[model samples]
Target: MAILIPFGLKMQAQNNTSGNKILVVYFSHTKNTKEIATQIQQLTGADLFELVPSRDYTTDYQALIEQAKKEINADYKPPLKNNLQGIDQYDVIFVGSPNWWNTFAPPVATFLTSHDFSGKTIVPFITHEGSRMGRSEADMKKLCPKATFLKGLPIRGSSVKEAKPLVERWLREIGVMK
Candidate 1:
């Protein structure tokens, strides 16, 4: 179930004719992160890009958690199967990731580091079990030092399917939506 997204949300697409290009880049192992990414793409009329690591991750939840922890602890950046180019054209970049060990996943780190966001505005959106953003935002700031960051939106992983209203409210509060 990708998106049985609320009807109101479908009606909320801004189509962003303000002449600023936007992009939504995300990595989702459970599809929870992708759910929110899709909503933001629909609402903001942004380009959508998925970060697929070179190798598929383990399906075992316990193993996945252990692997993610090790990667995070080691500050390892996994190679992605796909990379986005022409990044300079976008003024706002929405970075979506599932929080791993209190931070964004390693693939997301690779994506951020691979681009030059010196003048771009980075908007982070995370799906977490309970940590809620955790150190994700601060970590992103360190990785993309020249980029301006908006207050991040954190939705519980289990609640992503029902996150429409919260997503809308945050977009409006951030002046991305009217």
Candidate 2:
């Protein structure tokens, strides 16, 4: 005999919670940052949005870094694929990205600059090889001047799955979960 469960209920059971309205926006180059975002979504039940670059970066790591440096140096704001509607509906905005050249990824910069996050609780999470949050925390402060910036979680890209404890701690810090 086979037992069947409602698909919707199964999905709902896998999510963290629906009590809190949260949004998770992230920029991932080689899927490192995306892994972190997925974990946060699991822990917070936040709606997820990918912060994609209008132009894909070069495949060569060093070339990509150099190109990213140029964009950051120029303070460029590349266009995003989609914009979050009803952003004000979310009580918390969890932004994620891979640290590039000691700062948040350029596409994430574009997303933050383009949106008005005033009065929102802005939480940042970053994955990096070694820099660890670097200048991202301060940079987010400047970008979302009107939003409440919470202390963020920084995890090594290679250790993303192992960061569940830290992510839960951060969620608790923000009062998202017990």
Candidate 3:
């Protein structure tokens, strides 16, 4: 039984403008994070992009865990597809990913490193079983030292549908949507 909730006043309060160029980028293995990204796109008319690894992870849960662990332990930066051409056009970037070992997915890390975010604002949205943003906010600052990293929103992977309002509220606070 999936649940869906609309963005309420808290979200609307954050909407100070009617037009903003927002970009929502994420990488999902189980579709949980992607679903959240979709909702954000729908409300804000933000452009969306899914990070795809050069090689896909195995479908077996245990095998995927092992692979993720190895990458996290080694601080690996997996190769990513050539990013969206001219992604720099956006005013703000909303980065999303599933938490793996208390950090952003390796592919997302790869994408972060590949781009230059000199003066852009970055808002992180993470989905996890338990661990939330983990070290991702700090990691993003490290990766894009020139960009402004804002407060992040962390949601449970099991409660994504209930997250629409919260997600909208966040975008409003960050001045990404109206």
lDDT tens digits by residue: candidate 3, 1-178: 1112233223423442645466778898989999998887776766678888888888998999899999988979887654666767776788899998888999988888888899888889899988888988998889989998878989999999888988888767866665
Tens digits of per-residue lDDT for model 1 on 1-178?
1222234223435555445677788999899999999888888777778899998889999999999999999889998877676788788889999999999999999998898889899999999999999999999999999999998999999999899889988987887776
Error of 3 at 71 (Å): 1.0
TM-score per candidate, in order? 0.91, 0.87, 0.85
lDDT of 2 by residue, 4-50 (tens): 11232334334545354677888888888888887777766567788
Shift in Å, residue 23, candidate 3: 0.9
lDDT ranking of the models: 1, 3, 2
Worst 10 residues of 3 by lDDT: 1-10
Worst 10 residues of 2 by lDDT: 1-10
Clashing pairs in 1: none
- lDDT score, candidate 2: 0.79
